[model samples]
Target: MLNPLSLVSPPALRAALRDRLTFRAKLTAAFTALFFCAGAALLIFVTVLARQGTMEQFARITMDHTGGPTAPQPTSSTSLAPVSPPGPDRAASTPGPGPAASTEPWQKAEDARLARVEVNNRLQETAVRQMVVWSAVGLAVMAVLSGAMGWWLAGRALRPVRKVILAARRMSEENLHERLQLTGPQDELRELGDTYDTMLDRLERSFTSQRRFVANASHELRTPLAAQRTSIEVGLADPLPAHLIPVREDLLITNREAEHLIAALLLLARSDRGLDETEDTDLAELTRQAADELSSLAAERTVVTTVHTTPLSVNGDPVLLKHLASNLVRNAIQYNHPQGTVTVRIDDARRLTVTNTGPRIDPTRVDSLFEPFRRLDRDRTAVHGHGLGLSIVRSIATAHGGTVTAAPVPAGGLRIEVRLPTTR
Candidate 1:
């Protein structure tokens, strides 16, 4: 035989399994089932006790009574007392029939006694049957009522849990200071809420320390890099020997790339730290500005650029939002083949999509493109970028409470889509 579990689809089975894990449902089902089973047991015990009692009463009495024209009629009493035959003097006066003739009334009396006993047994059985049926019906109704009551009680008992879940959802890494300061009786639920708040307290402190460290490190790192860049520009401004000229240019290029990397790191850190404040900013205008700035780069690569946009406003940091657009367009241009096309589109829903014709990316490996410092060539010295472009785009979008997704195009290249809410 096929396993019954196999008949259920995987999704349906998962749903059922998850439902069974619900605390409220489990509590209600357990209480109802226990009550129903116990009630049935009690009912069965009473029924059997009543039946046994009736049988015992029949066993105790003789039931050897005679029936005749002058005999007393039967009654509804449980015990039937045997009657003694008429005395010898009374029999002599009555001139009763012979012994064999007397057998008729005795036989009839025995038959009548057996018949009455059978009828009483049937009546008792019927009474017991009716009692069982009605009791069962009452038990079923009570079970339903108990289930409903249990469900409500369970919900009330679990109210604190819902509060914790809501508070956890509201308190992201950026807002770890929020706490579930639940109020009510000092029960398990209250204790749980208090524990959660304590955990958040520790988390908030840790995040504050980390943010401070990042800020200090960023300042320290940028200072030297800026000085280095200035020195290179001033010291190497004059022409040099034929061989020294190439060396000077290489030094300048290396210094500039280093500064770019440091700046990218700071931007990524700021985006991950989350927006401090938000304002209404037109995404269409930002996209135009960012893409326009990269127009020269696209021309240098001989890649055609196309932009389609509509007025779209969203609430976020303007600097970060512009960078998000700039990075996307820059990556499209930088990674494309000569004569390839880059298309940027925006809509009123605060959505932006940038499609580019480039070398085909493996569908499976496309997800890794969003990781910090991941390059398709697997080299940190790749010409186009330091591999932080997509990662920074993802961080900025996340800080704005938006989503970004990329999929490889069928013909070649990638189509990246971003979705942002219209308002904060």
Candidate 2:
């Protein structure tokens, strides 16, 4: 049976709703909570005091009506009860010897005062209940107003922070010169913007230095290589001595490999710097050309090649796009089994795929194939490639706002796919 707890979203378990709230929302909540607590405390204090005072006033008025704090006492002592002087008239007026006529007048007055005090208490209690209801209504209204005010204050305070975020997000290798230039007091937000600007300045300088170095290195290294290739081709000509034939062929092959390595390196660096201009290029044509260029290698490896196209096109640097296609096709062919099949295809949606029937590849380690110098275990110690092919392909694709992914095909082989934005 599935665990009920497992049905919960992973994110829900990792972060609560309150924790996921933005900084401004959290600050507003804090403000509203504080205001509510303070207001409630003040209202409760006043309600208690008012109730006590009202009750005390009711007691004082009750005492006044009763004449004194205690019942009145007789000033002089006399007979306990009035006895009529032995007269027949007194006996005739009194019906019986009952003590009803001898009752104290103050006792009746005290009972009437207690009834008035009870009525007053009921009125006071009613007033307190009404006061409590009104207090709750007032508190609720104030809470709403407080929440609105807190939200407004939070928005105002976060205005500069939002600006800083926008400025940072827009910062890229091509636009490293841009700055926040935030003008305000030397508070934390202002300090944050300033620090961000400083970091950009350093980044701008570093990128500039890196590009300069790449350019200088490219020119310096390519000049000597070109000169060497020219010397070898001219001095060694076509027909040569049998003893020197192998040496000449070796030199030419070595020179060609060096040139290829340098070209790949330059392509990687160029792609990293991003595209300066873009033009509509048909990816189908590039895919075909890549296959044709590597036809000799495939023939030597006894690999069969097939190309299919659907007229896919994208807006990007043609040279970089061509290199990306070439690298993918070359990697597939170079890492394939003898007499294997390499198929290339591009669709109208600007998706290019290359699948090869090569040696079985570990599915889990397929992703590492795109990293520089990372190769399958079968080719790990082989000197045929330095494994920069896929890395360059990825860099170029990213420069063109494209993506590349690779997966191991079941039953031994690999499949790679590249997707680029269609031309507008």
Candidate 3:
């Protein structure tokens, strides 16, 4: 058989013990239980005190009727007049009062005591019954109020959490710039909202950059493809020797441009995926090798090349490091004036500085030089470049956990620097 206590146990209490109760449910249950218990305890105290007071009042009333706290004066047992003793014959004739009459003298006192006790018992019972009714009413009302208050308080506490949930539900990549902008004290919830807002800010910038990059890439590719197609169409128009030679040359040039564009795109993509391998590498050696590899390109441009090196070891992907150095050197040579000097230096602090003599660069446009496909109007000609050299250098340097900075030299050139973390 189930215990009566088990039958009376609250379902919410059982759920809470099983860890299946909601926070609001637990809070309401706790409030009800607390109010009920307090009411029950108070009722019990009042009932006991009232019963005791009623009994005491009844005692005083009973005592007043029968004399004070001292015992009542003993009823006189002596008879007022003397009477002659009955003979044996008379005694036999008059039956002695049996047990009923032998204790008749104290009958009044016994009746009074019984009467007081009955009244006290009735009064105490009535008082306890009234207490029960009042207590039940009060506890029911208290439970209702406590539940309402508990729910309100719990909702207030969880408001921020609900806001966060709603904000997250509404979020998407396209709408990453939106922010919660929560306004309140700097509590944990507020801090969480701020952190989420900051993350969205970064995501918005990255997505924007990616979109712009893709659009520019498509435009760049289309330009060369359109040229190649036009060249082919014109060459096929007559199928003559004169048209064929020029067409072949135009096609080859366009194909070379397309190839270079594709290679640059692939390298950029690979760099975005980060380094594939890392090892101890000397920046000085990489710089020297890059300068040598570009010697012919430099010579063709009538640009003088000089290399200064200091052995600086760093941990990075060698191929990417080589690409970074080569790109920087190539950019210096390609953008320089004819007969200009290109200086490649690897300092003791693991910095690679490439300085070249070129046309004066606008200081405002220095930062944009690292952006892919971004070139000055003058450098957009066929013989100049695809405007990806500086961009590739920046990407490769970033992949190696390094930074690149550039500034226009006062004498009319660009001085670029790449700083890498040295291996201990």
Return the top candidate by TM-score.
Answer: 1
lDDT of 3 by residue, 134-218 (tens): 8788878877898889778877876787787898887754357688898999999799888888988888788678756855675
* Model 1 / residue 377 / CA error / Å: 4.7
Clashing pairs in 2: none
Using all chains and alpha carbons, the TM-scores for the candidates as numbered come to 0.83, 0.80, 0.48
Worst 10 residues of 2 by lDDT: 70-79
lDDT of 1: 0.85
Which stretches of model 1 miss by more than 4 angstroms? Answer: 1-21, 58-99, 185-187, 376-381
What are the lDDT scores of the predictions, listed in order?
Answer: 0.85, 0.84, 0.78
Clashing residue pairs in candidate 3 are none
Cα error of candidate 2 at position 347, Å: 2.6
Q: For residues 148-194, what per-residue lDDT tens digits would candidate 2 score against the true structure?
A: 99999999999989998888776666578898888979999899889
Candidate 3 whole-model C-alpha lDDT, 0 to 1: 0.78
Task: Select the stronger candidate by lDDT from 1 and 3.
Answer: 1
